[model samples]
Target: MAFLWDCYDAWQRALAAEFFGREHAGQAVVFHIDDDVAQTIREKHQLPESLAQAVKPHIDLGQRSHAFGTILARAQALESEAQPPRSLPLLAVSVLAASRMSRDAEIQAINYFTPLKRLLYGEGADDNDRKRDALDQSFGQVVELWQQLDRWLRSNKGAFGVSTITPDKFSNRARIGYPLSQALARLADRQKLTQFFSDAEITPGKTYSSAYLLRMLDAWTNHGRKRFSRRFEAALAEREPAFASLIVREAHGWDGKVLDSGGSGHLLRLRLAFNHKRARLFWVAPIATGISGGTLTSGGTEIGFESDLSPYYEGIERLPLTPASIAMPLRVHGRAAAGDPLVAKYSPQEIILFREDPHLGCWVSQDSVEAHEEHLLLVSPEQQAEVRQVLQVATSGFVAVPPPLFAAVLPNGWRLYRNVCFEDPAALSRVSRRHTETAARLRPNPIGRPKLVGGLPVLKELGSHHYLQGGAPDLLLPAAGDGSRRVSVSLGGRTPRTDFRATGYPIPLPQDMLGPGRHEISADDAVLSLTIHERVVDDGLPLGTGTFGSMAEEIDNPAITPLVVLARRNATETAFVNCDGTVWDAITPNVPQWLHRRRVLENAPLYYEIRLEPHDRGWLIERTARHVMAIPGSPTWPKEDAILSAEARTDWAKLILDVTAPPKHVLWPVYVKIARKILNDHSR
Candidate 1:
């Protein structure tokens, strides 16, 4: 509608003023489909730090800023001094922290960290029958909260009381003690009622200690998150929730990547629904329009330097909303079976804004509303691609700031992305997780070729950059296991066979495409020489043979033509021809690691690997030939089909086999039969 575009136009102008500091109302400051959104923009173009901080979150996420030990010590010291507990909230977190209930809990919220049973004994938790059932379970479960509290009380500074029952009852339910029954009653009353001594459960005129009764009340309602913990709270937010949630209308999002800048970002423009009913929710779920912020995962988190191992090293981190994170608009979703009411809806519940009587403030017309819901969201790098794909069809408009919060990118009706960066995030940094990937096989299924000597994994970004004198950065290899140990590597000078850089590959025209300047880098012995050009990426497409673009493994065949040869899948005229054989394993292992030995196959291409070692003027397939040449109980043409296909490929890879070799000469009849059987298969 015209009104929608008009509002968009007005929002663009507002963004121009906020982001670019443009003073004129009519100035053309619209976000063009092409304008870049950067982090920490140029000084003249960015908002002041003061201004940026002014745009705080709409929700009031609570923070617990003290360490557990400090809180515990303070609470204990106060008890030792016999002073009335001054800070109820502090005492609560300390007791909760000391309680076995919180031992395994890592969450920051007072509610979430408290044992499910201990939390149920609090006031607000008992409003429903489901909660009451939880409360009753706490009294009767295998290990009751009252039991733990009783033992803790007996241990604390020699405090003890005559009890009605013992805690350990195995599978049977334990009866409540007089001291604990009074504590439970105080908790059930919300800890506010003054006439607690007159309660039906409490003994007349006998007083209970503050440590016993007050500890159960008020302390559970305060702060979230532990303090002084240096662990990067990947929560994006470091606070816990307190109250109601608001409704959100429409949103705008922007996601960008600058490989050169080593960064990616998300930003949003949200228009919310305002009303008296929604006022309280705003205190916990705050929103501000046109804001985008995130730090580089590399420099931001504690997983430093070599990030190949850290989980958060990737972009678009999915930090789910914990009670310690930004407040959710809906009730905490429980783990329920699919289609259950307890399971949260993927998005939020839908509603309408400005459609009801007395329009609160609808900046855009006819827009429906979603009650500020952040339920289950699936986050992945693929979502970034989808955003860019949809943007390719976007109508011409200034769309600034992708929603940094993924919850804003939902439902597809009101959000748009103008661009997606094609840059590889991996290109931004050099990571060496594959340092152990020493070699590539000569082929997908190789037959006795020396694994090529690729000393180190070649970097993808090495393309398009040349290094002059002192031009290259220090090559930091994987740190040696012993720091004192050192190994030497050399970029050897041109060999006498410089005409071809890599070995085990075929001859000219289409093979060994590095052309003029070629060098083989090797480790140990030779002193280094230097020459640099941009690394090329040629994955041995339709052309080259034996070598895939670069020589990753080292193969030694002084004679190239004889080494690289063509062979047929079958002796038939229509058989597919492929190049094979070049490198011979300089030395094989003591215990041979054979590829395939005996395998039953209903089909002809039984795909077996042959390991041939040199014999007297011939080759003996050392490990696996006997099994393939002859099955244990049957002589089938198909078993021969699998092994010899590989063997024939190996033979053809070496242009022709020397028939004078004893292995072939003595087995002439077998070779001839091999030829006839294969040639007859699907014969034309």
Candidate 2:
């Protein structure tokens, strides 16, 4: 994460240069002023030239008398609009001066320091090479292991090393498999690790080292190795603290089981925790395109877009495409008894897969259900027949696209009537609060509003710390006395708090200023300050531009816009941004409607979006675009059209993107800069 403190420091310097006519002198200076005394001096009818000269050292001496008077007026305006009883501006000024001095000193220190990049990345040539090779190989192995795990986990359901049968009825009820058999199976499952170790030339008695074993374990388990590794290490802590630390550091992922006391203790613990049976299985089906990007597959699979289109996704009524279950096994159809109207809704088509959750029955398969009408209706059994008939009638070479698939899973009857199950309690509560807050924010006078979707109202505790949108500051500020003269704000808007005090760096002021006081005009008066200073800076570079001016200037350069990108590698969100306002978003937004309806084919946008504040600079567009492109035929572009014509494509693409791309925000400093120019000086 880039720090915001750096940007604040830069802005402060820019303010000094533009308003005080201070050139970039070889050395930075610290000054102080007394705000109360300064105010009194400004209010005086007249001051003797000697008195004025005495005060001049603490003031922007270069400022014209008229300009000086304007400063005092602006100060008063700030005082009136401030949030509370204003402090003396002198103190603020003195603080700023000292802060700048400290920053300059730090910069001087940096000048004397040696660059550490080479030291960090370089060691003895031979050792460095070995380390690099080892790291690269380790990463490759990790990836291969992840692929293996992903494949193994795709199975609908099955026990790895256990049988369901038991001699005792109570034991059978516990679902516990014979421990010895399970143990043997687990050992067999270690073949992958064994192969890796062998390939790496590691052996238990001769060539093996603990690091090698740990590395092998990490590769085999992915990040799931943490828990068991910790347990094992904890058991060995007294004998080997160094080994324990090493294991903890190497550990990652969430899989693994340690057989303590040569296996007996492990069995006992498992039995105790799970009533003699412990089972875990994970199943995920990426849409047809896999988990590469945010796109809906013909089947029920969904991948995320690098940048999620959730705002639009959540607002849309249904998916843009329709799919149905064309073929499925276990098509056990039953008709409703004639007496009950509700039960007569449809000829129930029952299907079952490995039941992962007790309450979750088979999800509705979009490939099986056909759509003919604008709206999909769950109607009486008679209605089902009519709908099917209508669908058949319309099947005669119809050109219209099918409605997006929507699905739901009905819990098994027994689980539904007997007990409720939730996947993640924390997640459930979080999602509930966010949904409710969003719903409330959408309406006028939202007090006592009902939820937009069916779910429990989010309890206050759940959402108290949750900021659904727009909570964190878009830009960070470093201490002023960090030797940084100007804070480059990559973000677009002005910071929420323009005046901030950073550790080791005080608020900035002139070399002669001093004492507690309010600094920088409030927003209402900021415009006036800008009007007087009217300084301009290059949008693409750090260079200053023409002096104060009221004429508007058109910035047609590509550098002014902010660009955003997104990508998902291994089920994680990665985002990026560019100065030019071209934004890319790739997100595998879950289609909740499909999940809620228990449908196999998800009928909703794979991404969603919600507009928050104006713009944030840290947004990355490159990553998003790249991630989206990684999806097979994403945007479903033809392979032939996927080609980029020339190296000059940047110029062409920028033109096209400016007209066609989605708009997003820029980081704070940039926003603040642009805002200051437009609102304050009326120049673009």
lDDT by residue (tens digit), candidate 1, 160-199: 2222223211112233221111211111121112112111
What is the number of backbone collisions in each predicted candidate, taken in the order shown?
A: 21, 124
**How far out, in Å, is residue 550 in model 2?**
34
Every candidate's CA RMSD = 30.1, 34.8
Candidate 2 residue lDDT tens string, 463-571:
2111111111111122121112233221113334243322112222221221111112221111111011112223221111112324335755333322222223332
**Lowest-scoring 10 consecutive residues by lDDT in candidate 1?**
242-251
